[model samples]
Target: MKILAIASAGGHWVQLLRLKPAFEGHELIFVSTKTSFKETVKGHKFYSIPDASRWNKLKLIYSLICVFKIVFRSKPNIIITTGAAPGLMGIIAGKVIGAKTIWIDSIANVENLSMSGQIATSIADKSYTQWPDLSNSKVTFNGNVLS
Candidate 1:
């Protein structure tokens, strides 16, 4: 199976990395915002997109363009994201191209999903929450990435 792991920099990337051991038998690709992450997430292809927030329209457009190029070129079988914003876009694109998607809500979202995770939930095939009871049945209880 071909797996594409997508996330933003910092904590999101850290969370996605925990799934690394699970994908060892399959091909892997990783997408994130930090160029520096190339060193940390080893043994997979990597892509970087411009980071954007709710207010950055130009950056958001540019990020979407980059996403199209990357997704088309890679054509992954599955996409897993620990997100901020761009990860939501990736989930939709992945779905359009017939990729199964998993959205892992940030551990930082103690009471609710991050804005990105909330959006991704609409399209993701499976959603996981680190906090068990806080998770709705729509969101699976996946335990902690760190542990």
Candidate 2:
């Protein structure tokens, strides 16, 4: 199985890495905003996309173009992310290409799902919240990346 794992830097990236063991034995490809991550993700295929934020419209556009190209080429069987902006782009691209998508909301968002998480509920095959209390009809709490 080919799995595409994507996330932005910082906490989102950390949480995504925590889920690495779960994809063991699968062909894993990672996408992140930092070139620095190439060292950390040594054994896997890695792609670095331009970082963008919701506030930066131009950069967000550029990121979407980059993600579209990457997703089109990779054609992953599954796409998973712990996100901000870049992860959202990956999820959107994955869905358009028919890959099963999963969104794991960052542990940092204890009170509510992040904006990207909320958007993912509409498209992702599954959406998870780290905090069990935040889970509802739309989202599930089936354990967390931190575990």
Candidate 3:
């Protein structure tokens, strides 16, 4: 099975990398906002897109296009993201292309699910929260990524 794993570039990337062992047997394709991350996923495929945020409309649109194109071409069996904006785009594009999407909210958002994580609850096939309190009908209380 092909799994497309995506994240922005900081804690999101770190958390995503922690899940690498889970992807051992599968074909893994990683996407991030930094091409510099290629070295980290060295034997697998990697792609980079412009980092964008809600505060930046033009960059966000461009990023959405780039992410959608990658998702469309990869045709992955599953898409997973520890997100901000790029992962959200991947989930949306993944769904459109019939791939199962998983949203793993950043662990930093203790008070609530991050904005993108909240939206992902309705879109992704599965959504997870590190905080049990944040888990509900839409999101599951998965064990901590750091643990």
Candidate 4:
């Protein structure tokens, strides 16, 4: 299976990378911020797209375009993300192309999910929560990614 792993840089990217062991037999493609994550992920099929904050509309639009480009080109079987904004873009693009989507809520979101995770809860094929007791039916208790 072709797996497209999407996330922001820093902790989100680190968490996503931990899943690499689960896809040992499959081809993997990674997408994250080009500038902040250049050195973080090495020896992988990587693509750098713009990273956006909540107020950054221009960056979001550009990232969406890039997401479409990546999604159409990769045609991944599954799209998995641990994110803030880019994950939402990947989910939309992946859904348009009929790919399965998974959203792993960030460990940093201990009591509540981030904005991206909240949006993803409505669209993701499945959602996971690191905090086992968060009590959101949309998510399963996946434990922390670090553990």
Q: How does each model score on lDDT?
A: 0.84, 0.93, 0.96, 0.87
Q: Per-prediction TM-score, please?
A: 0.94, 0.97, 0.98, 0.93
lDDT of 2 by residue, 31-91 (tens): 9999899998899999999999978899999999999899999999999999988888989
Q: Write down the RMSD of all candidates, one decimal each.
A: 1.2, 0.8, 0.6, 1.5
Q: Could you give me the TM-score of model 2 versus the true structure?
A: 0.97
Candidate 1's C-alpha runs over 4 A off are none
**Which prediction has more favorable lDDT, 2 or 4?**
2
The candidate scoring highest on TM-score is 3
Q: After superposition, how far is residue 139 of candidate 3 from its true place, in Å?
A: 0.7
In model 3, residue pairs whose N, Cα or C atoms come closer than 3 Å (at least 3 residues apart or on different chains), thus clashing, are none
Worst window of 10 by summed lDDT in candidate 2: 138-147
Ranking by TM-score: 3, 2, 1, 4
CA error at residue 105 for candidate 4, angstroms: 0.6
Candidate 4 regions exceeding 4 Å error are 35-43
Model 4, global lDDT: 0.87
Query: What ordering of candidates by lDDT runs from best to worst?
Result: 3, 2, 4, 1
lDDT of 1 at 131: 81
lDDT of 1 by residue, 61-127 (tens): 8897787678878999998888877788789889889999989998888887777777777789998
